[model samples]
Target: MNTSDLKTKIQNLYQDILINLDIEKIDDYFAENYVQETDHDTLNLNEFKDHLQKLKDVVKSLSIEKFNDMLIDEQQRSIFLRYDVAVEKVDNSMGNIEVYAIFKFNEVGKVISCRELSKAYHEELEGLANI
Candidate 1:
């Protein structure tokens, strides 16, 4: 896929799949052997789907506030994005987070693997003393 197309797909993956919590459409974007790595754990496609399902059940609302940066390297078949996200739970508590995600796409343009690192609002202030 071209860089533009790859960028669009990455954006849609977040907006249409993650923000919308459309578990049924996961296959449309991810390869059958998709792998996801996070700070704590790594998951295959099925496990990742289950994680999304759990998030859908627990979080009342989710939004990607800004896609701050996107870089596509066609030669490496990789895409990177830095984004801000906001989530609100059923209890009305909310948090904003910043995330950096890297995706590797298959030849046909499906995401074969993804690695994400995120920092919550509070996590960014770990060394601060006064509130």
Candidate 2:
């Protein structure tokens, strides 16, 4: 696939799948053997799916507030994205976080591996309990 198409696929993975909580479409964007690494842990495809489901359950709403940067390396078949997220949970807790994510794509354009770092800031809202 071309670089443009690969970029679009990554965008859709964030916009359509992650933000929209479209768990069923996970396989469409991620390779069957995809691996993901976060600051806390590493996960295979199935584990990643389960993680997304748990996130969906906890986060009532999520939005990509800004794309700070996006860099694509065709030779390396990798994409790096830095963005800010606005999150509101079911318990009325809210936060703004910045995330840096790197995606390595397979030859067919499906994401084969990913790594992410999230910088989260928490501010207690008056009378709002975090669950």
Candidate 3:
């Protein structure tokens, strides 16, 4: 795939699947044999689906604030993204997080694997440090 196509797919995967918590559409973006690593955890396709399901159960809402950067390597069929997102928990607590992910696509252009890292903080807590 070209750079634009890869970028769009990644964005759609984030907004459509992750933010929307649409587990049903997971297959549209991932290959049957998919794997993902986040921090110290590793998950296969089923495990990833379960993780999203759990998130859906606890998260009231999720929104992407902005995409900080995106780098595509057509030769390697991989892309890296850095973005910020906001999530509201079931109890209505809000968390802002920055995410960095590298995705590798299979021969057929489906996402085959990913490695990701994220850090969270409360935007409302920023002013407390100065008080």
Question: Model 2: number of clashes?
Answer: 0
C-alpha lDDT of all candidate models, in order: 0.80, 0.80, 0.82
* Candidate 1 local lDDT, 1-131, one digit each (tens): 88898888888888778789899999999999999887646889998888888777667888886788988999888998988778776667777767788999999999999898877785532211111
Per-model tally of clashing residue pairs: 0, 0, 0
The alpha-carbon RMSD values of the candidates against the true structure, listed in the order shown, are 5.1, 4.0, 5.5
- Which stretches of model 2 miss by more than 4 angstroms? 123-131
The CA lDDT at 1 in model 1 is: 87
Cα lDDT of candidate 2 equals 0.80
lDDT of 1: 0.80
How close is every model to the real structure, measured as TM-score? 0.89, 0.89, 0.90
Q: Pick the candidate with the highest lDDT.
A: 3
How does residue 3 of candidate 3 score in lDDT?
88
